[model samples]
Target: MLHRIARATTAAGLMVSLLTSFSARAIASEPPAHCRDIAIPVSIAQGQPARYRVWGQLCTPEHRPAATVQVLVSGLNYSHLYWDFPFRSSQYSYVRQANRAGYGTFNLDRIGIGRSSHPASAEVTLESNAYTIHQVVAALRGGAIAGRAFGTVMLVGHSYGSEIAKLEASAYRDVDALVLTGNAHTVSVSAQQNLAQLGQPVGQVPRLAAEVPPGDNGYATVQDAQRPEFMYNVADADPRVIALDIATKETNTLGELSTIGDADAPGVTALLRLPILIADGADDKLACAPDATDCSSAATLAAAEQPFYPHSPVDAVVIPRAGHAINLHRNAEMAYCTIINWANRALGTPPPSK
Candidate 1:
């Protein structure tokens, strides 16, 4: 993996554009053949620091330019290039298409996941995560470290990261496009119900921001690795996803819970100010649970309830024979193609269709 750590010596002034330059050569430490690490502090009042991983090639136009910038934000417990990212899904085709179209691709793993800095006590709440993303945007836009400016950056987020993407799109004016995957309307599982489902005592489930041991509450153990197929079937169809999977653990239970309830409700799914695409697996447990029901239903509910943000155009779809990670499963390339097509049209650079 290739990575470089950068600290903001001066405050990233909001109005004045303070640009920092980082040449590709400066990124001396190559991220794993597939991963890179980046750190930038949050601008939030006393908010903890934020860090993320970058993946894929950042080839320039003369090389393989598709879209201007395509960023993939992984769900909790997953880091950049963590899994074997075999390009099996339609999503892969979309990435290739984006590259062909002139877009540089990147993915940022939120704090507490991946190689990013974990707060002294991991603060995995949605609000904090949203704040971290805000800092990331500021750093990226202000040229804090990598100093790369995206002409047309598209945000692709899955599971919990989808909520973060929504927050970023609604709160920041910088993002041009948005994609949300594995969305649930309201967690079908209430606090009590969630405990029962997890077979834990009531009130034992940690808060949205609490940190638990890798095996404390919501984790899949090494012993459970025997069924890698069942645990991560969605990643199997793609070598890239598999590679990514190998680098991550299922120890983000608190992070997932934090995305639910009043703690998670404040800023998540607020309003969309830009074009948005939402995709989900037909049978994702998070979307098809007792309260949520299914992926399509959850998408519709989220869109309908947040009617105030109607100015942003929206499209939703459900993938077949897939679970939570639609982009890593069967027909992965189709998923990517669909999203890229939507993004292209939104960015005013529609691809030539056959």
Candidate 2:
């Protein structure tokens, strides 16, 4: 049956070689055709106008210019690397896959994470984060970040990033399409438990202490030992990938976590009038477990989410045997293909045949 074949393909993709010499050589020899680090200045409200820089990397394809640019946003406790993962770059890097599919990618560190400026943790909320993303989107469309302006913009988000995307798209209605991963209307009990225990003050974690500004103790990160349990399905992931994720993990703020569920408010998602793709890993304990949205298959997931997106033509895909961090999983290639292919169809841009 087709279902059986699909499952087999996912399993096989995970079993593919991790670090062959040939892969390393290919990676070293071929970098992105066009890549640049960008810092966009944004002003957000915290009782007064506060200015900060949102950092990101923009990369385009080698042969032809991309017509549609994807603005990638990471989830809680993750940085820009979540979208363009470094380890096993050949299989797990969504940036590489998007470029190969002829789409430009802007992988960003949200205002309070990674290379971006760290404002007082209390100033960083879902609304402020969404406003920051709005500025980035405006900058991209106005040709402020790169010399070239992108007419078609797609917002791609994972987990908490997905929530931000929902808020931005609803509030601004600026993007052409939405690709939301690791998110749904329902939250699993396991996800709540993981969230409740996942974070500790940034100052307490030696690895993250230097990353935050002095006297600001509001940023938090998942404990290194608990990361694999919270974010990955060990059986379907590479051990090296897990180690790399922990080593490169980033911070999330208390403000961001406090209002994380704001985007799920009734009538918010229903305001959008664009093509949307909701993708999640079947084994993602955070979003696909008991009492959460049914992610057993695309149809089931889409049906469950239809009420939330009454104005958009929404499609869903459930990656098999993967966890919360879909891009870091061995079968990430499938997830990449699914997203790129859906974007192509939604935006009317035909992808080059693989």
Candidate 3:
């Protein structure tokens, strides 16, 4: 795999973009205390590699890199904090749960979001972001940018991030397995209305000015008032968690917004031979409604998903009462355990005791 990456001639070979001395900024400047920022050179276009310092959190079972690693991708307008969730370390943290289960996780801020380089937002589309993800995978595989190597890699993504992961897997077929969450083929009306509220420029938002900066074009962040309904099931969510989520919201480019309908990934997912899992928050207003076609239970979710990945073993689960932002929900551990357990079985790792 490393050899193929090294020899690739067109927009493939990449290098670490941050200084040899990595910057140790926190994902949310709060206290989960296990993540840092690392930069990588992503080939955004042919001969156009740009330095992007993606922020990520790392957690391994025994304080060492695990044999298998999961590369986590957050959905639109989110950062690595989505997985680490500083709100309540005991309940809302997926990173801690995965770490305790003997799995290594590296969750990153997509190229144009978070502390990563703010490239011209117009240039960072789903397709280009997938390439950035591919480079991160290659860097991890060869121990180039991330400083470690794993025997296997599992790609895990939420919402829009799942789309990028699907594209990466389809184009490269480089990872061992995949896990997708808060996603589905059909876009929901509730989500569409919520998304429309974010039409204003990100730079105009008072809380996000420093993060969005002055030059990037075509990027927008959701209005603070619209976040709770758009991201979480209001009745089931903790008001505090939703507050922090809104405070730290990231930006998404017009490229991501405009090009997504053209990048529907069920067809690509169908071609994957790797183990597959599609887990959704059962009450997700944006992606998985209770009345959704086959979303009532895990069996239904699995049944509807089996056809998408014919060559791979497909599994699905609906985390009860949770919404689109599964990790931020009060019952987040259920979703985290679902993912960690599936990843264990899929990658042939020794299963964790239940």
Model 3 lDDT per residue over 226-299, tens place: 77876788788888999899888888888888777544644776667887777788788876754344577665
Q: Highest TM-score among the candidates is held by which one?
A: 2
Each model's RMSD to truth, in Å?
Answer: 12.5, 5.2, 10.4
lDDT tens digits, residue span 1-354, model 1: 001001111112210221111112321222212223455555332433323332233333343233366666776544554222544422443334444444556655565554454443235566666666666665555556355665567777877677777766665666888887766555445523543343222124233223333333443222223323332344435555555554444335454454544323444444456766666666555664446643444244335333434455556555555666665575554455455555655688744321
Better of 1 and 3 by lDDT: 3
Task: Tell me the TM-score of each prediction against the true structure.
Answer: 0.65, 0.89, 0.84
Could you give the candidate ranking by lDDT, starting with the highest?
2, 3, 1
Per-residue alpha-carbon lDDT of candidate 2 for residues 192-310, written as tens digits (9 for 90 to 100):
87668867777877767787878887888878888898788899999999998888888888899889989998789989998888889999887898778888777677777777877
Q: Number of clashing residue pairs in every model?
A: 44, 0, 0
Task: Please say which candidate is ahead in lDDT: 1 or 2.
Answer: 2
Once model 2 is optimally superposed onto the true structure by TM-score, how far is the C-alpha of residue 118 displaced, in angstroms?
0.3
Best by lDDT: 2
